[model samples]
Target: MEMIVSFILAIVSYMLIDNVVLSRFYGICSFIGVGNKVKSAFSMGLAVTFVIMMATLVCYPLYFYVLVPAGIPFLDTLVYILVIASLVQIVGLFIKKTSPSLYKTLGIYLPLITTNCAVLGVVQTNSDSQLDFLTSLANGLGTSIGFLVVIVLFACMRERLNGYNIPKAMKGVPIALIVAALMAMAFMGFGGMVG
Candidate 1:
């Protein structure tokens, strides 16, 4: 029962308190750039979630059993980049083949997932913390869900704000940045819940 509770707590804490974009500030580039349209943002969120989960699935065991045992833990980051690049290629190809429009909409950001800090952050965090496979997987899922929530909500807010009249200085990126900051602060309020 304690193990089950821990697993659940991991998910809740990450999703609410330590959100990948809003709290930890990982993946902010894509979070801001591709977050203007709800449909596109939703697609990006799902893609990211898939990559994080799949990468965690592969990286956890590979790092603990292989890298650490070989006494080559320093190569972990390089290995992780390779794995992430390969996964991004796979995702890009699949998206291009199945949904040409979304592929076009995502454009550079799709491939940018290879370098996206959030994707790399979760995988590296798992290894750095030496979390067991199940716990690491739970962490990945939590972060992914948090990413989805923030991006989708941000996109929705942007969509709504588009119709409103705004001052010259506070329009466009300025407004978006303000909204994101407010969101970060709001998510920070949940810190007490987990800690």
Candidate 2:
């Protein structure tokens, strides 16, 4: 029961705050580059979250049952990366064939997800935390939600800033970075809850 509660809280916390791109500054490449519109940004966020949760689902059992017990924990990084990469590829291909529209929308970014640090971060956290399968699932879902929230928020901000006059030095990536940093500080408020 306690575990279940923790899992739920973790998920909610992750969704409402502590997003990867916003909170941890991971996946900034996609967060800043791809997040120009609410729709596309939301899609990218959902895609990233989907990948992270699915990858965690596959990686955890492999780590707990196979890698760790075999005295090859050092191999965990390699194995997790390989598993995630393969799973992302398989999923991307499946989506491309099954849904042409989705394929068109997400196709370009799908490959980029394979190497995103945010995805790897989720797996690493799960392994290190020793969370049970269900908790890990909850954590992954929560983390993904967090990612989505941040991406969408950033996209909205970018959209709002489209017409703003900005100084040459403070334009583009620099302003985006500042916004992201401020967002991270905002998310820190939630960190106290989990702590």
Candidate 3:
């Protein structure tokens, strides 16, 4: 029971309070750019989630067993970047071969995941905290789910916003920014729940 409760809390904290996109503001590039359509936003979210999980899986073990033991923890950032970059390449190739349309739809955003701070942030946090493997996996999964939830909701809102009348100055990216700010504020409500 205790472990189950802890798991539930972890999910809630990550999904609502520590949301990578909304709360931490990581991965905003693709968050804003690919969020105009629901399909694309979901695809981006899933891709990001997969990359985060894979990176965490590889980075955590490498950091603990290799870097720490070798007394070269300083190389963590570079190593993590390389690992994430390589994983993104594999994901990209898979997408290209399996679903060319999604590949085109994702376009630059797919590659951008390599540089996305959110992905690196997850791996770095896991390594720095020295979380056990299962906990690290949970954190990565929770963070990705949070990313997916926000992007999907944001995309839906953007789709609806497209049909509304608005001040000329607030059209396009301006309104989108405003909407994102509002969403961020709404997410702040969950802060107290975690604490």
Q: Pick the candidate with the highest lDDT.
A: 1
Decreasing lDDT order of the candidates = 1, 3, 2
40-156, model 1: which lDDT tens digit per residue? 888788888989998998888789889999999999999999998998888788888898777776665677678779999999999888888878988899999999999999999
Most TM-score-accurate candidate: 2
| Clash pairs, model 3 backbone | none
State TM-scores per candidate.
0.90, 0.92, 0.90
Q: Mark the 10 consecutive residues where model 3 has the least summed lDDT.
A: 102-111
Clashing pairs in 1: none
**Model 3: what TM-score?**
0.90
CA lDDT, candidate 2, residue 94: 98
lDDT of 2 by residue, 100-180 (tens): 999887888898898788899889888887878887887789878877878888888888888999888999889988888
lDDT of each: 0.88, 0.82, 0.87
What's model 3's overall lDDT? 0.87
Residue 174, model 3, lDDT? 85
Better of 1 and 3 by lDDT: 1
